[model samples]
Target: MTDTTPADELRTAAQTLLDLADDTAEDMATNDYWRSAVVEPKHWFHNGIDNAVGGPAGKLAGLMSPRFARMLAIYFRDEAGRGQDFDTRAVTLARVMNGGQP
Candidate 1:
């Protein structure tokens, strides 16, 4: 029997979402609806799926792995959760991003 943890499951699910998004990737240049929507990102955000980061973005690749997801969530969820400030949180997040290699 294989042992798969919840993080592993979430990772798989994230991958599936990325794959599905790729499968249905539409060229914004040729997509009038999408093009018009992005023209006023904040306005469209009030409608649905506010996934934009800076302005108009998609496919959250940073959540590619469970570890990455956890690290990011920790930093964003609450800096006070661990009694760490912004700099500390940034350091912690950076360490995880480096994969603890060195």
Candidate 2:
């Protein structure tokens, strides 16, 4: 058998979600909140997928992975409901990617 770590699982799940999003919806524009949301561990798979398609910082690939694009939509929903702060959101993502508080 093969070994599948939580990170790998997360990546796969993330990729799937992003693909679904691209298939069903429109692309997400980069904004302060989106920038913040993109960094969380929960969203890290999107982060990687985004990078694979050229993230916000690089080029505008236009949801190269639909699943990741959709996962981003869900995050936006939560962010909207909670009225999350851009800085706070960004920090969460930072923590997820950097392995500690940002």
Candidate 3:
């Protein structure tokens, strides 16, 4: 079977897109147009909230742009918090569905 772990799968996907950008343009992500189009949409918070608190920013971070990475950094200040929030929600939902209310 595939030797990829879940984490590695994500990395591979990200890197694949990044490499595509690299091939398509010498500076694809660095371009303002690409940044505004791709990086701005997918920056979601714990509750599907936009960090900028408005319309879609784009999918730049997901596209593997460095600039998008930096912007993501600013928008999502606490990575651990986000992960914890997701985990908390998942466990809570599981417990609720299993009738293990607490």
Best prediction by TM-score: 1
* Sort by TM-score, top down from the best: 1, 2, 3
lDDT, candidate 1, at 58: 29
Q: RMSD in angstroms, candidate 2?
A: 16.6
Select the stronger candidate by TM-score from 1 and 3: 1
**Residue 23 displacement in candidate 1 (angstroms):** 4.8
- TM-score for candidate 3, residues paired by index: 0.27
Candidate 2 residue lDDT tens string, 21-84: 6543333343333344436534543565456566474344433445555555455444434433
Candidates ranked by lDDT, best first? 2, 1, 3
**Candidate 1 per-residue C-alpha lDDT over 1-102 given as tens digits, one digit per residue, 9 for 90 to 100:** 997433433344344445444443333324444444344633332222334433343234323333444444444434323332334434444444434321
Worst window of 10 by summed lDDT in candidate 2: 24-33
Screening candidate 3 with a backbone cut-off below 3 angstroms (N, C-alpha, C), the clashing residue pairs are 38-59, 38-60, 39-58, 39-59, 39-60, 40-57, 40-58, 41-57, 41-58, 41-59
For residue 22, what is the lDDT in candidate 1?
47
Tell me model 1's lDDT, rounded to 2 decimals.
0.39
In model 3, the runs with Cα more than 4 Å from the true position are 27-102
Q: Provide the overall lDDT of each model, using Cα atoms, as 2-decimal numbers.
A: 0.39, 0.46, 0.37
